[model samples]
Target: QLIVVFVSILIAFVAYTSQIFVLWNSLGGAVAHTFFVLAPFNVFIIFIYINYALTCTTDPGTVPPNWMPDQNTHFEVKRSTHTARFCKTCNNFKPPRAHHCSTCNRCVLKMDHHCPWINSCVGFENYGHFLRFLVYVEIGSIYLFALLSNRLAQIVEELHTSQIRPSATEATFLSINMIMAALVIICVGILGGYHVYCVTTNTTTIEGWEKGKTLTMKRMGKIQNVKYPYDYGVMNNLRSVLGPQPLFWLWPRTMSGTGLYFPIN
Candidate 1:
């Protein structure tokens, strides 16, 4: 909790403070740079909160107590899929697409992966929030990286030419900002790409490894002709996570779906 809170505040502080340098030196000394910088920066922060709140509060959905398997479902699922669906830990029948997260100590319906960053399990109910968070975070990192690099370059040029000797504090601060941005880009960028691949293929982190195959072996598209069933289509798959409301895809809202039940195909 402390770490999460600290990081959030640090992000906001770094952004606003850095913008001070650019705006202070601009012609007429107006706040244009600061305002422009904060526009996307603030939007990104809003998404961060939205994802964090939803992921933290929403129940990932659990198997009902004393649930019974339908006779038809029993026969249709085949012995292999049906046999492994029971959770010995919970002593309950697991739903299709559900997996037991040892960290959570229970079966999470349509379980993705446990994300410690949000201090929550990113399962059925909160997968959309998690995914959206990744997207916005990656965007924010790249955006900041671009903005800060320009500032850093100017400082570097000044130092190289011996035009002005920068103070230790100013030098350290600028370098740290650029370094942090770079790390965010590399770390969050790769993570965001993986989630994007997951969305396109309808595979989660855990699901990709189970059933004896990693998703890297397969490609997702119209003509793949593979065993990935959850992918309805690109747009429909996106809507499944982002909700059906076109205008609200970027807004803060819970996604549509009963986490307890999902269509496999």
Candidate 2:
């Protein structure tokens, strides 16, 4: 996991460095144009690193030692059992939407999954940061791809209309950077898109799988209709993960809720 994190950072560093070099050299006297392109690119890069660091370092919310369910609030119990959900491993009451992660060796609140790149669980506390990291990565990669493509087109034009040709070294670096950007776009695009859907619907990856199972059982006439409790509505669900302020959704901040008790639909 550490290796993966290191490699991801290294790739970002290399791509950023190579793009700046290529752009500076290629757009010789167009300093204003360079700034125009780099201003937003740099912002995305900063956000990407910031969110990544937060996601890696933040605790994904853990159950208090010897914690028990509150009788005042409605709490989920073990399926088909009246007793509160419990983790034998943690020896503590499991909160609603919480799951025991074998990797972390504890129960995590609203756990989405264990991400290797960040070397942490995407759960209640860090989920916003995780999502921001993905958003920034995808945006930055797309920006890089556009810049690289424009440079490539210029090189091709120069070759066709003039005797000058781009240096082999620059071409090689450009190719590598472009390939890396494309991969990030495609991979992160799909991942980010899925998580966006999950957030809008107020569903975690684990709950999504459970929902599928429930549907199957219903279809087989083994169970009655079931509804996911967390889905308040499209707008409210988005606010749940991203916070109440739409203006600060992309900013670094913790989400609302105690992670132990969530409002139901």
Number of the top-ranking candidate, with TM-score as the measure: 2
Clashes of each: 0, 0
Summing lDDT over every window of 10 consecutive residues in candidate 2, give the lowest-scoring window. 11-20
Residue 189, candidate 1: alpha-carbon lDDT:
87
TM-score of 2: 0.95
* Candidate 1 TM-score versus the reference: 0.82
In order of appearance, the predictions have TM-scores of 0.82, 0.95
Off by over 4 Å in 2: none
Question: Model 2: clashing residue pairs?
Answer: none
In the range 98-203, model 1's lDDT, one tens digit per residue, is 8888888988878898877766678887888777777777787787778767766777798789777656665676677778878888998899898887877777
Worst 10 residues of 1 by lDDT: 214-223
- The lDDT values for all models are 0.70, 0.86
Among the numbered candidates, top lDDT falls to: 2
Candidate 1 — which residues are off by over 4 angstroms? Answer: 20-30, 70-84, 160-162, 211-226
